[model samples]
Target: MASGVDLVIFGATGDLSRRKILPSLGALVARERTKLRVIGAGRSHDTTDQFRELVKEASGNPALAATAEWVTLDYADPASFAPINALITGTAVVIFYLATPPETFSPILVAIANSAMVTKGDPSRRVVLEKPLGYDRKSAKELNAQLATAFDESQVYRIDHYLAKDTVQNVLAFRFSNSLFEPVWNRNLVETIQITVAEEEGIRQRAGYYDQTGAVRDIFQNHVLQLLALVTMEPPTTFDPDYVRRAKRAALRAMSPLDVTSAVRGQYEGYLDEPGVSLESRRETYAAARVSIENWRWDGVPIFVRTGKALRRRATEVVIKLRDAPLDR
Candidate 1:
């Protein structure tokens, strides 16, 4: 509707955009923090009118539905990226939200770079990406390179929504704010640290996708590892971005690959017996492993992480099993 304030979505009609993104953006608009002009780009066959209606239904939020714009795009098509660039010509801010999958990331970046719509050296032009950053370290680096070719690392905001949660922030408060934790957190005072995330659910519908990427790539690589990093990272002299990231990367690097014997990777059978999936594929439905950080601070501490689909209840928690005090008192 307006010239300048645009919050564009690369995949507007998808599950991520409709279910979470639109509602969150609507909340921002409701609070009057942003004057939003949502531009939805995807390769849908439907017209703008049909797409808008779809968004209205998908969003289910009355506030966001009132302010929605739909534009069709194909990342595979070279012509699609220019118009988006033209829309960003004025002083309007641009926020590219990539709701697409990990595989589509490279081509999308290439298109954005080749397109006429992208603006370099603009602070307001930000791109938000969700994790699992990559299937592994190599893929993550590859992804970083592709984007770095066109945009600076500072321009990329790698969003881990878990960091936004109150529980996660509380970990920092418990560790740094209290004398109890910061002092006795070393190997001398502490024993093994077990961080477990176990689910009882089976792969009811996501069998196809889940089969391809098991617990390691899906959960441990991002959420569990990130949580462990936050919990175990040394207190920074000053809490700055560079220092915090450095600490995390160091913790991650310190962790070695898990031994399959100590780790349990299980998959529930009879899923394909219900409907779509075939019998031959043996993708894991459940996995649990103990990750040890080989450092002076946490030399023998073991961090256990477990996750699965179609469980009885859905729970995500980190338990710090501290070592017991001596029986002298």
Candidate 2:
């Protein structure tokens, strides 16, 4: 709450809005509610007052609820952008959020960029893109180029919510802060690395998106890859954000051109029966791969990455299997 700003969420009526994003914001600005002007915009017909009430119920706290104000937006109407446009003018830091589907992303950004009264170079404006930015590698690049037209590199924040978990944070603290791990962190002592992210629930309400994305795009593209980078990345020169990101990028880059010989893709039983799924669906609900890093420190060792929905156990962690000690029997 250091500065007063507009906090706009585009998909305000979506399930993510009620379940996590809105409530997290409430918790964030509970002490300094006045610093943040929470604005929720969506296609629904709810007024600012009615949407305010929805925020209250979803937030489960009166103070958090009072922070949110809503604006009705229709994708087809030019006039619907008026309220948000008015709010974005002369902004300090407009933390614009696109909490909607990937398909709506490009159009919304275009609308925002086109409708804003101020210049696109406004230093205060930033857009936070949710996970699964595109369907695949090609589309991802196009989406990146499109987003760049509106916001500079520094002004864009692509979020991987799993990175915010306490368990994940703890790993960084242990790895960097402790000097002992580096001595035995490479292929010399580590036989193989295993990273797993599992889910117990099936494709409940997200079949339309899930059937298209499956575990590969839904999990591996962002979550699993990020986890792999974090666990195996070379130690940075320093723990600063840029340096840390560099190490992670290098780690991921080393594993390029994934070998399909060690990869597996599977569809969970009864996935076709899920609502919005096709009977002839060839998509995979489960994906596992053996990632081989072609670097000096990890040349021979393989990192096994796996993620799936409707799994028996739900867990997420990085496991470094060490080489057994040689002994005279």
Candidate 3:
């Protein structure tokens, strides 16, 4: 790790990297905080020049385009990982942004560990993993265990973008910092919490991928579950990492084991009938569920989650129904 910091985007040419990442990074650089050097790595067979052009065009900023550096690096190749390490030598912070599918994580992790990219002696070396951590609870535990072997819990940052929202952050600050909300934050004070991320667009070109994941694995498993924990977890005794993590883990454990009856899974007729979709795919397009937490703070309150593809509107927001309202009298 170098003194400052450099961010290496593993799937730099992908949809997420180009649309959200490069633009945001550009904004940071434009603000004169270029201490963070960004290296674009992906499976795209493009040369450095082509990838740079792709980022600039996708980022939609001429200045950012000119400043970007592109490198053709396969995440699974240890030899390719060397350049990213070389670019940010000397006490610099290294953040590997994995913008690829969850299935690619293990291979990439192994390659980085073997390439000297993740310095065991360096305190600032970091890795960021995206959502869809696993297809289910069993797989999630396996993934977590594998990550733990190479990087300490503190070194791994599991990124759930939903938590980055202004409202979600405010939820924690409001409940803990103010005496006004803390007393009434529990089940006795809150009725029920519902988190919904609705989408109107059908599977479209995502049919192949979505067919395997469905709504549960795609959104609810990681995204909505994160929101549920944030809204319902007990306040950390302190801001220390262990305390905060314990509180969240407790909330997750408090959730009653999911049952098929408590949840509903659906698929749209027209979506599978679309030009590219198969008639026999078992993937669910829509899923909704009411989950209960078995803790004192939220014993009876139900947390509801539902998400779907190919229909309706495109909106994502959380709704918290507070139980302690003042009487009109």
Candidate 4:
């Protein structure tokens, strides 16, 4: 929200950057009329001018491109971060957004901590990490420890972009604000809740990342779970982000562990032949599971969640089926 904010996006040329980050930043600049310095950081050897062209093309906003610059960054090399540090002024708010894979997070954070950009206890300096945070519970803990070394919990943000979607945010408003729905949102009136996130496109350029991270890790862990939490969470006392997050966490804690035996996993036909996919890979492109929250409000209600790639249609929806009214006597 500040005037002189420096936004350094790692993996600037990656799919996520091209598809989401750059475009969103461009729109933000256009909408807020804020003075933002965009630094596109990647391992690519592209010059500043070349990177600006890429930003212009991806964001479709020349004004965003005009404020953009590029810096070569190597997660393993501390010296690579020097260029990034030099670009930052003493008083500017610095935001480091990691758009790279989870494995690279540790080294990148260490490199950032060693640089002059991050001043300890400075809230103005922040880091944003995109999920899936890690492969599993143990790895996630390790990642948290790594993050702790570089930033305070307050300064570190683990983001699931799905939560930023208007429809998804509206779920909270629809449940809490609508008297018609809020009264009947519990298990007594709601029979079941089904969340489905389907994608029509196959793993096009992300075969390498997709194969390593299947449907469960890629979608179910972050996006699907966040949706489930939003739907099942109790109304927070306040609209503050921390309170909302606590409500979501409470809902997640009440949910039963997924029953592995009842889970379904499958791969799309011809998936094995996709580039970077192993011939014998057992990675699933589709996954579905039955979830239950053992809480007063949601008890006896079944929550079904599923996500997939190369599906019949591309849709993300939450359907709540209510109990039928008694027949007329």
What does the lDDT read for residue 75 in candidate 4?
86
Q: Which stretches of candidate 2 lie over 4 Å from their true place?
A: 1-3, 31-34, 87-92
Q: Candidate 2's residue-wise lDDT over 57-116, tens digit each? A: 887667656756778887656578888877666667778888888888887877777786
In order, what lDDT does every prediction score? 0.73, 0.83, 0.76, 0.90
Better of 2 and 4 by lDDT: 4
lDDT of candidate 4 over 39-156, digit per residue (tens) = 9898889999999999999988898898798998778998888888878766368899999987788888889988767866789999999998989999999999987877888898
Best by TM-score: 4
- Total backbone clashes of model 2? 0
- Residue 158 displacement in candidate 1 (angstroms): 1.6
What lDDT, from 0 to 1, does candidate 3 have?
A: 0.76
Tell me model 1's lDDT, rounded to 2 decimals: 0.73
Clashes of each: 9, 0, 10, 0
Q: Estimate each model's TM-score.
A: 0.87, 0.90, 0.83, 0.95
RMSD, each candidate, Å? 2.9, 2.6, 3.5, 2.1
Local lDDT at 311 for model 3? 53
Candidate 1 lDDT tens digits, 287-327: 78887888878887777778776566777787766677678
